[model samples]
Target: MDFTSLSLAYPWEQLPYALFAIILAFTIHEFAHAYVAYKFGDPTAYQQGRVTLNPVAHLDLFGFILIILAGIGWAKPVPVNRYYFKNPRLAGVLVSLAGPLSNLLLAFLCFPLLLLADQFGLGYKGIIELLFMIIKINIVLFIFNLIPLPPLDGYRIIEDLVSNRTRAKMSQYEQYGIFIFLLIFLIPPLNKLLLGPLFQYLVPAIYRALDTFWSLFL
Candidate 1:
């Protein structure tokens, strides 16, 4: 899973821009979560002042490094007390879903500029690099966050859809969530056994979809 086999540049020359887009997109995602949570009556994130685009407000150091290494990255999680909401389970799921949805929205919003560059063939090297990083990062962010593991957005989405009994049962696993996540990252057998097959399909699907969208207006 090193950069060498990913066929990406060392990202040496694009390091600054890559890092900036990663930080900016990640911060925006988290900020959207906090903002939506606040709107739905959870003041926890607001009190902590997480409802802003300032990367410093939402940056997680280890998470940032993972972005540099092409690992699925994360931002500081915004706190939300679902109890404060009119419909706790539903609002909670919405807040959880907001982060990745924000990233997709950003990709689509930035789509036109990339297409413009592609259309005119203006500095193809730079534009293609920008498009690649932005689109791939967004796709990875969307898929990684959607994994139905504890403490991830998909868990909440599942909670919202399933019975209260099931939600309560799953809640017990939250304490070990990060450990489970690390195991998936560090244990070769599990990564090879589970993640490898999943990504074999997702990677190409994401790229094809991105290409389809680009061809529409480029």
Candidate 2:
């Protein structure tokens, strides 16, 4: 509750800010999908009254807890009925990609904030810490969601790209999806294997970009 009061180290310090980033990212991510789906004529989310930005309506208790413990978890998915779409396959792709793409946009937005802070000589540790979290969370959400795993947005996008036969076969894995997902996430080798690029490259690039952008603007 006391965000600034929280103390965390160089690596772990990003946790609190990550918490806020995830909440904001997922809220907007899901909201955008819902809004677009509604605009495109799917009323399921609207009918369920999920068009609001109040994250309480979207947060998943288990997922929220996982963020504190495991560091990655998801809010409740915004309900979408693809049958309501005029072009189900294409619509599904956009809807699925929307979540992670929103996070990327968030990361981009953070750059300007960092620059603004720097301009005022306000690149305090707290602000840097917050920007770090923003970068990490956005990248994690982008790469993690882009994984072609079941029920994740990335998988839907993949499904749109693959053959119909594969899609049909893959549907069977849906029921067991989350367990498989967590198993992979918790498996150290597999987890690192997945995040190697994210930590080694993507994150550093983001930090450098923000720093450079700030230098230019400030």
Candidate 3:
């Protein structure tokens, strides 16, 4: 999606902060997936070294560029083998949820730090901006990946919830899902109409949750 629709004002000075935030968020997200998969008996991701916090291990070159420019992107998907799980469906669902859940948890964990930065004005301008960007971008990544589209973590969750027949039908369209996402995202009216509300509500709501937590102590 275009950055404009998301109202992502990327000033030149803020690029470094934004870039760091994306890398940190993406790394944690993918690592969570790999870690959960390994715990659930899938050794593939762990064996491939995906269960680490290294951003380079998870960043997809094109996806990272898109995240910098367009406000939404992906990382390398952690590989999971159904055969490894005792209950494949449950394991799959938990593994899929891990990525976005990790982002949400990270955002929550950053709330106090964000409040401290605002209250005490800790660090220089870029440092403060980086902290805020970390919270916002992690929230965005969490919500965006839960859109129930193929190749996204959400779809795997959806797959577990649906009937076998429906799952088969949805699987058939998986290959074309990214193209469909691009078609909707690149078009102005469609992007604004569809994703705009998500930005307006979903994002602010998350921050508000963090705010509510901060209010308890502040």
Candidate 4:
């Protein structure tokens, strides 16, 4: 199937590159969550077979389709049993943080390689295009998941830090968060207030940081 047909900007030839980026981003993010949970003594994800890099292990069919259609999506959430942790609070925070952190780390590593590909002209056209998609997708994944909304990694991190009563309150709204998210995107004013700065400012800031870091060594 021609995935690029879904994209209005890029040519159809770039479909493979975009698909690779989405799969890699989703796989690593979920794997990091599962791995961290296992490291912290939670065996739930391991038992459920999520502690692997296989994209199928992480991808949610509906979410992947949304990614292709709208430039954003999600993966299956790794099952984590925090009660197994020696210090549930610390372990919980770390495990929840791993997913987004993995994406940021990926963006960091890809930036320099992207520069080299561009400078040396190594398969410049396709390779550079692939790396750019990979970097952008990873950054978007990292930032998007950091919103302090229920069911997202960011809210889990907050759940670990905030009082138990507050966590309970947040948990009550968890089921409605996705519906609320869709509404935010559908409503222009809400979308502008919430997502506008993310794309316009934060994303560019990260790119600038990547460029500055590589410039120092080059």
Order the candidates by lDDT, highest first: 4, 3, 1, 2
- TM-score for all models, in order of appearance: 0.85, 0.83, 0.91, 0.91
lDDT of 2 by residue, 1-218 (tens): 86665433223555667677777877877887788788878999998877879988778888886776666677888898988989888888888887788887888778777667666767565786677567667866777788777778888898887888998888877768767887777787887787666667866776687668666755
User: What does the lDDT read for residue 100 in candidate 4?
Assistant: 97
Residues 120-206, model 3: lDDT tens digits: 877676556888889998998899889887778888899998999999999888889878788677777888998899888999998
lDDT of 1 by residue, 111-137 (tens): 667777777887556876777677666
Best by TM-score: 3
Per-model lDDT: 0.78, 0.76, 0.86, 0.86
Q: Is candidate 2 or candidate 4 better by TM-score?
A: 4
What does candidate 4's lDDT look like per residue over 73-122, in tens digits?
67898998878999999999999899999999999999999888988997
- Candidate 2 segments whose C-alpha is farther than 4 A from its true place: 1-15, 175-178, 206-218
TM-score for candidate 3: 0.91
Alpha-carbon shift of residue 86 in model 1 (angstroms) = 0.2
